[model samples]
Target: MLKTLTKTLLCVSLLATFPAMAAPDGDMAPSDKQLAELYWQGQESLKKSDWSGALERFRRLETSLRRTEPASADAAIYWQAYALLQAKRSTEAKATLEKLKRDYPDSRWSKEAESLMRQTQGRPNVASESSGNDDDLAEIAITGLMQAPPERALPILRKVLQGSHSIEVKKRALFVLSQLDEDAALAELGNVATTSNDAELRAEAIRMLGISGEDTAIERLRTIYAASKSSEEKRGIIQAWMIADKPDLVMQAARSETDEVLRKAAIQALGAMDASKELRQLFDSEKSLENRKSILQALGVAGDTRSLVGIAASNESEDIRIEAIEALGIADDDDSGENLVRIYQAASSPKIREAALQGMLISDDSDSMLKLYKQASSKEEKQALLRMLTLTGSDATLDLIEAELDKAGKQP
Candidate 1:
């Protein structure tokens, strides 16, 4: 009974894949917006199971696209036929399918139409008929094994992995193997992660191991990370560690990993985990300018405005200071605007001043900005403040502009 159910599930999966097939080759023309809206209405109607409404919309779409986009018209016709089948009008559905096949023999919808034709004729779907093939049978067998006791299922799943089955079949077997709670299942998954000849399968097993959240699985992941030479594999391990909420593991990679790209990936993961203190420490001790910049960016992602404020005010390189200021803008913490105002006041370089002004603008600190404009000693500074204030379009700023205009007129 479970075997039959598994075969049925396999057939359903194949049928589901039909609608997900790629659309026709060309991009839709801009003028097709109205037609696109009509198509969306049809899809929405189909989703609601309003068969008559769906048929009406698609019928209209078919007539409209019949001339310039016969391929799209064929798609409309296919959906119209689907609506007919759902409404239990099989005779009309068959007739519509015949029209699709006869008019656009090369349509992308032809394969799906043939399947619908079998449905109308009360014959089994092609998916069910193809279930006797070796790959399909293997997948079906593995899916069925998912319902059995773990002790009985694990050995069969293991054989499926070791045998000459297709990658898809083995992936299904691995998936079932991962679902089991036994020690044997973890061992098998670890074996696949470490020894699989296929890189894709190995990555899949690694991801599954992390998701298992078992102590042994976490240890295995660390062991894999230590020995793996592939940057891609190491990056995947870092991501898995992030998923498992192991920030210390991620920070370890961020600090020690020699590959710059992988190290940045780990830093980014730490930011995502909101490891502000660790990132701050890394920033202070790190000697490489590029990695320090990366750590600052990570701090921004962690929303650690205090660290960013310190970096912005530090004697770091102008480039690093500007990066921190910009990250502060992105962080947009409550005190960011106040800190930016202070930075602008203290900065000696025109470039640093400009970056600080931009940060103020981003933080929407228009009040502090207007105050700076009032205190400006140079025409360049006032003009720069005017441009950023114009972007804000605040009434107070506009009034200030008008007042400045009057003062300039009197001076002339």
Candidate 2:
């Protein structure tokens, strides 16, 4: 069905010709061959997802047709409207399509315009005009029901989900069902997530439940994760739990999950949920370097600047300190700025100093970095600070660097 729609969009460039009409510039208009080339160029742009390019080409064609072949202008006009729609300029597309209909009522392109309008509005295409097909009728009825008052639309959509409708229809019904705030609606979504034969639909249902983020939805996800044996399925449940901010279940999975990958996924989810205190505790007890690095990454994601600073300051291993420094950079909290400068000043190894410079850049500690730059006794340290300022991309620091450059230029 989606492919059919894509083909329709791709074929919009092909058009019928009419007798010559007036040219706005009072000059010879582009021949049909020339216009056809432009049309195909627009189609090529559409194929490449270049909406702006397609819009420009179609608009040029519309202008050329308005002058040289007024009757054939509707095709270009319809395609222009279509390009606007594709560009996400819907208000303009609607107006353009309306103009196409108003200006060319009898033209075949007007029917195409109508179909495009229907598509934009999510209505069934009357242009297809296939009657007596029960499936088609049901789809149309369901579409209408979708737009009806929730009081009226809810029951029918639920029935549609339960019925043996097409997967596409079921997906649509599921979406509508998910929007309802009622317990029954959430239950159906959970049912789909847990039992749907279609993997994609099941994932989508899980995602929708996560999006719901209600207590019941979170509980259902927790239950599904506990009962599911498939790692892929459990991973999906963890992601949903992350979205729902069910940190306790995520923390439990992180600690107790037998699967290494699933455990890591749960840890990442914990980071995303900002469970920094738990991750800090886990880091202190964790023995493996790999696991400790993962904890550092989660701390970065959690952006717990105080904890990251503590890790940087106190971690005994050089590698762990470097990792903490890198994590602090990823965390990007300005609160870590002072600590980063401290790390840079006290570090003996060049690599640790380099890591501290990176952390300072990421944390946007321009003032502290510049102050250190001015106080530096070594040329190497001053040069490093200059590089750090440039790398940080802070406008204020850039201005200072520019002024320093200007002053240096005058000295020689």
Candidate 3:
């Protein structure tokens, strides 16, 4: 059933296309080719078990289609929830599923969402089960060990880690091991993180080390990060640093790491940590335009509106300024609409003004758009505003569009 659903969703995505409508100010909507590229990239990420990467691509795809293609948007939503569930973020997965059901209830993806929702409810309680499997029994034992003395639990957990148990059971054992205060337990967890053959298990152990929040565990992560050659492992360590709230460590990597991917991963981690001050400093000192753009994106993720506004208003590079304007829309702060409108009005470059207009759309500032429509000086500008208003799908905007059409028809 899951395979059939996946094939159906893929067909829906492949067939999705933007309507043949010109965007305001000559800004073009993403072409069908671009959307297909995003979908294929997301599929590749999922095949590699790169859940975060898949989620990001699918989320962008969903946002691109939300206003124009409800069916495609719902399919993206289902994939987003699937990625979240695979990442063990059940709470977020459940929320995403709820959104699909609430907003796209008639969608074919809704039935797949129901199955995912059941999975998000999690495994059955161990105590009530009569015929428990190895994984279930392992969970039960781990639960009992939580109350036992550390000395007793540590030895058993160590054996479990060394045992031929399933990866799921071993993961449970590893997590329990991380909770132990003993040096022996930390060492055992570190060994798994550094030496495990299974990449997924190693990543889990690394995550558990971060969750442990022990200085020793943190030091061990640094050691492993310094020694590892795999970008995936290094990225995992960067995420672990974010979870441990070690922004300074992440900052160190962001500043010194030679790998652009790792550096960007660190920047993203800083953003997730809300290290706005650090991000601001990086943005100032960084010489690479690409890295600077990444910092801007992180700032948006961090909701640093003041910085975004400053860049949008004063950045020397037109491209950078436009990126900042788009970031403002992504930030969607209380003042974002006003700032976007101000930028739109002040921008001399058609591209910059178009970005501001798109920002307004993203921020859903219909009143501001309508105000701009009334203030527009050219027929082209008014037409663009009308098109934007139509996309908003508000009754008021629709009425305004109708009146504008009538007036235009009465003109010479």
Candidate 4:
């Protein structure tokens, strides 16, 4: 559903089978309070974006309320139509809306609903519309972006940005723009990243530039690291650099940075760059538990076979060891499969053993995998076995399952 046209929302679900099942005096009856509470339940469901849920609750109330008094059925019917619209059950919305206008000629909700039907062309019936809640305005704006295409949202977002949007809203708007229209939004974000007083917002703008992240942005980030008064700002810019895959800049900072904290950050950024040279250095020489752990993660992501030994080793923290074990699964090199078996053999603990099992599932070591399948216990452990069998498409396991199913089904 296009977000722009959803500047107005049109749906929820309403049905209570029992309300129409019997009246208090006869087959069906609910007091005004019960009807009001039912309506409130529908409202709650609507807010959660569970339109069908709301519709079911409202329908029961509608059915029950109709028997109590014909005069009140008007409101129930209107909301039912609204729910149908929200469910993206549009044919039903049209039907219910038609019923509303035909049966209740003077309802305010019906008239407004008719207008909604006219306006909602090209809109997916389920598109969210934020109501008159100022406190949730930024959230509404975000919701609008989530629903609206960049073309449609761009205009509304431009209006919000141009208007007196709250700082929070401005930040969210910048993010939405960056995601929706990366090239164009980068220009706007660049202005923010360069000049905004809110360094967090500036950093966010830089991060959102995605693949359009520019050399100018890189240099600006470097300059920010070199000159910013706040440590937080430098950290933010460094993160932005890492996200843009500017490993060279990160390596440069790690080699020459003077401040101990910033130097550590630079080193962390180098590890984050997921570059082979830096990953090797981290695996070989980094002495800090934290730093070595970070580097191992980089190695895992870099998928460099050289780090296979270091990742397979148990010298680092359990967390790093676990990350390294997982990394082997993704490495896809000849020795990667061997390294996983080695880790599996050497690894202890339920967790590392399980991680090793997972890694081996991706390895070509079918013999070792077959052993794990026989020994693994618990549903999750069995699931790992199934994943191994599934991904590898092992003929033996497939034939086993098929044979078992055939025996149960009595197929020849």
Candidate 5:
């Protein structure tokens, strides 16, 4: 039975790849042998700590691959950022790292970029000599301090946190201190979160406090959020609450916050928590069309597809209904595809019909769509259905259309 099941699964997997065979040639990703060779040469330069040489190679590779090999370009950008860090070009390195994380978030290279970001952001180069041993020693010292008992480590870490060490070293100390259970450690982190001059260091402190998840740490975050005049600081505090899974605090902020952008951030955080009930309640009570749209988006984020369908069905404003219809697609509401088709049939507005058709395509209701195409009375409606099928890249639907066209050709 197991062998039969395995064979069945293998056949199914191969069958799934058939759609790609019918897809347009534009779907193919171009490959370059020269780019691969140059990438390895850059890696060799990095291995030798030849920062300038590596930076030059990676920059050229990134320019070459940006359009043809986006994934490779993302990697090249990450390596370029690392090379910049190693070359003591701090500002450009930080910018490049941020770009990598923003543009290709799902790329494996983003993980390495995040690590380099933490090390390079606020910290100046503290290695007096361009020696690998010095770099090794700094890391080892931080690790050794963290491994020691709080009684032994606290004094050293306290000095490091307060001292004019490089930003990277201070960040390491803050992280280790956050992990410690000592009251003094929490106090130091709280102090840094509240008082640090460097915005990046303060954000890092807020992050560590949130990870600690101590009641006192949370209170500090709240206090900082309430007291800080800077919008950036408040945004950081909200993000820290998100990381700590404090949805209640986020919801509270969403309700009370005056800044439109920050309020949206809180709502997004609630959405990330799967707070469907809260989002749905907000959707019902919201008066502003903009806020209602946000609630629909949040419900989609929380995977509350049922609520989205109801909103799409009943919302009076065609524009709002269109937004909700798209949200249904985001929630992957396969069952709602027919509802979208119904909306399309009823909608007099071109944009609303377009939105409904787009939703159906996203839900992969190609079988229903093919039936709809057959039932269409007018040439315009039939043309619309054919365009939608092409947009969806439905191989079976395409085959059906091709057969119909061939039959027409033979008849003429």
Candidate 6:
């Protein structure tokens, strides 16, 4: 009896395979390579970010193969389902997956097909396939930090940071905490800074505290700045100290700072502060060219044009010169346009040369920039000037640029 039953099952399974083949006598089924080719074309479309194109390709591939070999359509079907899922056509992907399981349960694509069906339009309301990593999903949740009102996710992240979680979880939570400035997150980070023995956690807290700028965090940084012997920790302190609004501390950080990078950051921060005699003094006197560049960039954050002439005349490192050129735009002084032109006269380095040209566009009109464009020697410099001019698109400017190109024996 057992042998008879087994024979009957084999006969049925074999019979099931014959009908589809006999119906399509005149039509040649696509070869395996053809099917693979179609599958990849769809994948490429998806890769190019054209989800709809990928879906269309998959559908054609599926239909062409299904007539003679329904099972051969598994990859096409899976890709179709994936493209649909990516296109936010969650309902369609789920339905396609269901059909896949029903028609070809034993196929190689069955596992992913069944799993996707469960994920998208499942009872749990999770509409789509998931990344397998727990940390990824948690990080996706943690993106609530970028949501319009950040107060929502603050408490949950605080718990994750303080609680015993995996390092990945803590890392992602810290990232979200960095985004959030809620009283709760700030309070939790402050408490952690004071109490936690974990150096990494304390560092993370200090980083966030800089953004929050609470008095407690400031005091904590002050203590760390004074007592910590580690160079790395002091760098972190200077990094934090730069973000504060206290102008005096910024000058203190810049004038008497120890580390090169920390001093640069301090000078940058002081430049950002209200330009008192102290900030001006540091900008003029700081010996390092890099530190001076930092000071110039900070001056940008303060939005003052007073330092433009001094920065333009420095004749120091090209980097500092380039930074000063960019700072003219931040200063928003169209009145200083002529100064920028004269500065670029002596500016020979490629970066500073281009920056000075771009700065003129913001502070000078196209007509004024046309004269400078004539003075530009190489194609690269001319290209940069033309690009900036194109952004402004003034007719008078175009006319002047044409005249200059004619003079240079070049075409506009």
Query: Which candidate number maximizes TM-score?
Result: 3
Per-residue error (Å), model 6, residue 206: 1.0
State every prediction's TM-score relative to the real structure. Answer: 0.55, 0.58, 0.69, 0.41, 0.63, 0.45
Off by over 4 Å in 2: 1-154, 162-172, 179-181, 213-216, 227-230, 396-412
**Clashing residue pairs in candidate 6 (N, C-alpha, C atoms within 3 angstroms):** 120-128
**Model 4 C-alpha lDDT per residue in residues 203-247, reported as the tens digit of each score:** 556555422356555665666567767655565566566666777
Backbone collision count in every prediction? 0, 0, 0, 20, 0, 1
By lDDT: ranked, best first: 1, 3, 5, 2, 6, 4
Clashes of 3: 0
Q: Global lDDT of each model?
A: 0.77, 0.71, 0.76, 0.60, 0.72, 0.63
lDDT string, candidate 3, 1-412, tens digits: 1113244234223221111111112221233333544665776677567789999999988887775565567767778888888787888999999999998888766556777888888643333444346578778888588678998998888788778887778877876776666778878889999988877778778877776767888999999999999877787788777766899999999999998888988997888788999999999899999899879878877889999999887845987898788777657788888888888898798888878877776666788889999899998888777877776667789889788789879999
**TM-score of predicted model 6?**
0.45
In model 1, the runs with Cα more than 4 Å from the true position are: 1-149, 152-179, 358-379, 382-412
Q: 1-412 in candidate 1: lDDT tens per residue?
A: 1124344333223211122122333323213434655785777677567789999999988887986576668888888988888787888999999999899898878877888888789833343555348787788888898789999999889888898877778878876776677878988999999999888788767766765667788899999999999887887788677656688899899889988888888887888778998898888888889788778767876889998988888888998998798677656778888888888898889888888877766556688889999899999889999987886678889899899899989994
Identify the runs in model 3 with alpha carbons over 4 angstroms from their true place: 1-132, 390-412
Model 6 Cα lDDT, one tens digit per residue, 1-412: 1113244233222221111011111222234333544665675576555779989998988986887567577767777777777676788888888878777787677666666666576534352355336667776776655564666677677778767766556656664565564556666766665567766666656665665556766776787677766555665565565544556765776788676656765665565455546666887777776566667756765666667566666765666767677667556555557766776677666666677766666444565567777787988767777877865668876776677678889545
Candidate 3 clashes between residue pairs 3 or more apart in a chain or in different chains: none
Lowest summed lDDT window (length 10), candidate 1: 14-23
Candidates in descending TM-score order? 3, 5, 2, 1, 6, 4
Pairs clashing within candidate 2: none
Give residue 70's lDDT in candidate 4 (0 to 100). Answer: 69
The CA-based lDDT of model 3 is what? 0.76
Candidate 2's TM-score reads 0.58
Candidate 5 residue lDDT tens string, 1-412:
1113244233222221110011121221124434554675776677566789999998988887985676657878877888888788888999998888888887766556667788686566575465556556765797687668999998888787777777777777777777787777888899999888876678778877776777888899999999988776777687678666688888878888888777777787777678888787666666778777777767766778788777777746877888888766556655677677787788778888878776666556677678788899998988888887875557888797898799889994
